[model samples]
Target: MALDDSMDRDPIHGSDDNSPDRQGRSTFVAGERTGEIGVTLSGLRPPSRSIVEISPANIARRRLANWGAIQGERVNVTRRETFEYGFQAPRHLLIAHERGEREDGETLIEGLPRSTLREFNCKLSFVPAGHKFFGWQTPRVLTRVTYFYIDLQDRLFDLESGGARPTIGPRLFFFDQAVWDTALKLKAEVGNSDPGSRQYAEALGVVLVHELIRLERATTATARLIRGGLPVWQQKRVIEFIEEHLTEDISLAALAELAGLSLYHFARAFTQSFGVPPHHYHMARRIGRARNLLQAPTLSVTQIGVQVGFRETSSFTRAFRRFTGLTPTEYRRHRGG
Candidate 1:
């Protein structure tokens, strides 16, 4: 995909990272100086995607591949990918939040106060070595410092947010190998030699999105049954069953039978109790599990999608994006693990 021809002249394009001069009293990276492109980011909404595609050939040459602007708002820096290209402008700092015990992978980081986001001067670069899709390195002299996982198994690092004198977020980097795997899967699946398989993979990304949007609006009570407490127990049992065999073609009929009821009765009961119907609930669980897999430092969006019942990488990505506002790569970046 050719980029906009005008991005070349944009302020984000700078040859040297050490060209900015301090005017009044502003913080700058010691030893290495970077230019600041002044811009406001108010009302800029973070991406609501859940997948990323990082292929070697395309990823090696860095460029402004995935970013958008809002009217009269601060420029937002989103999940930047690694390639050979140099600095990008309108950079925004990514603040990583700490992880919780139950948080297995990238899925644990959710419901952030986007309203409380701090800003920072930011840019991304690729490391020469490594099989992983993403990795991170702090700035050092001589070599271009690439923060966050940019190699293959990329990792995130919390940086100072807000203008030249930005404050850094608290300590905590969410590291999950699964995110790397997912990216790799997408590269392979979408880049597969078989065109039919590739199209199927792409189609899945679309389906995934449709299912996730439905899940986002779903409520806990809406997920319960009219039978009240008994429905609750059944729902739990169904969830457990689905989790155990998610890889299988588990269907509403299968689930209904598991609960010793007809498909119609089971579907209605399940929907009444859980807010979503059986298939939708199952999809929610699969997507939820997929989110956990995405947190792995090694898995890519595609790989995680496959692991969570998505046969095609694109489908997984589409679905993941719909459920979370950010793509898989974006989600991992925010988590900083």
Candidate 2:
């Protein structure tokens, strides 16, 4: 059968053969030639130009395809800190051949320095299917690409209704494992015989976001060092400082000054009082806030770090692991929906 014929019977991209509408095709279009049907083709040349739409669904698809095409899993912001947005592209179907691959893999997609600690905003442009970003080939079957402009002009983009900021800002982000899993599930749902499967996925996404918000709160307190004393007054003051400058690094030194205590005196006193070091306390606060922002499936990890005062993803990871006993991915998996 010819490529176009096969496509007519079943689009190479969108519709799955096993779907309820098996006799028809979906939105996917691989390479359909005139009158071709399920014809096998390799080394196919992509069109000279490919345009991707910047819609939410399409953006989600594009990001997922880029990170999970070979891996089969979604991408997650793992260790966003000072240098770049650290992405955790989990091992999956396409690139399961390697170990520690997820730990070592990182792609600095885009950014510019805003100052010593912050970077400028970014406008994510959708690349055509099969195009390359870094070294990965974008999924070839996508119908549209979503465009997200990360406004880094202000690193602190809050979770409007949440207690803390969770995601990194100034860039588009994808979780290798999460994106892949979500997309695959979405695809599977679209192919499911049940009429409500797609609806379920949509519901699941909403639940996931809510769960993320709750988890962010639980984890944030770990980064802080709270103790006895002027409980109400101190809490108010600390909370005010933390909330006001979630993006700027919060240190024991700074906190002590705010509390009107010497570094040594504050360290010993605060530890005795809060049961943790000042630095640990501050970091806990930041991470907790970060966890909340991360709940937004849309924001990137590096953006989260920038929002939470992490100078780099590596530093964030180191600190996060020390406090939480798990990598960000592990935390997200256990905590995020």
Candidate 3:
């Protein structure tokens, strides 16, 4: 059959006949194509230029791509203290925070309001085409993330479906076990040279898309995080104040007034919004920022503590030990070690 005719059938399931989608197609077993349905054409040119939207500072990227369109990157934010991560691509991006913990950071996705909730280990973030995803973090440990780039097109963009697109919404810091597992499997084949690995990754990419189609904002816990939290403008203002005054003491009444809520209500709402009480969150931010400062060899432990709002070095050491199970000196040395 002609290539265009074959393209009309389900790419994964195949046409009525058991023949390959194209005439004389390579038996490399490639992944799903960004476009041009049916079995993917070998040496097929990418639909568009692949764009990676990570900052170049202190970032190391390992990229993987097959003869088709699915591209993957394992981004390692080196132990240089802190790093920023964001996405701005012509294609969709599936982000898996494989293993990373942040002491301090701001997460902003186009769909969700800005967020100050840190701890993103195993979190999943999906940024649809044309949306912006931005975040910068002061790390508590080495940060590693796998970014799976889904070629944005109309599989209508599934591998098994007709040319009609499925509804897939944007999500930030959400959880979806199916998408996460499929994305990780695809990422594992990034550098593999085995003959079947490419095809397997491609197949996994198709599976990942079907998983993404299952993302429903109302059905997920992500909506609850906001539903139980503060308003968007209030969350932004409150987080900004906390970030600006991390090295100083800020009162709850002050924050409450800022949020235009009474003291009692503000405390409850802030905790509900950020999953932590106001004071506890403030202190954590101070210590988190201090951890970042410790990475600078030029700064003395006492200076770092003072910079993060400690009146004395001893008090700073005790608080740091309380929060992180290590004194300032020990934490710094351990990080170096």
Best by TM-score: 3
lDDT score of model 1?
Answer: 0.37
Q: How close to the true structure is residue 43 of candidate 1, measured as C-alpha lDDT?
A: 13
Model 1 over residues 101-124: C-alpha lDDT tens digits? 110001101112111111111221
Question: Which candidate number maximizes lDDT?
Answer: 3
Q: If the candidates were sorted by their TM-score against the true structure, best first, what order would they fall in?
A: 3, 1, 2
- State every prediction's TM-score relative to the real structure: 0.32, 0.30, 0.48
Error of 2 at 98 (Å): 64
| Candidate 1 stretches greater than 4 Å from native | 1-233
The predicted structure with the larger lDDT, 2 or 3, is 3
Provide the lowest-lDDT 10-residue window in model 3.
1-10
Work out how many backbone clashes candidate 2 has.
50
Tens digits of lDDT, candidate 2, 1-337: 1111011221122322112222232111252211212321111232232221111222332233221112122322222211111111111011111111221112222242111111111112112122222211122222122221112122223336545434332222312343334334443333355666545755444433333344335434433333333245654686588678766645555766776654545455566666765555556777788778767767677777677767677766766676678766667778772
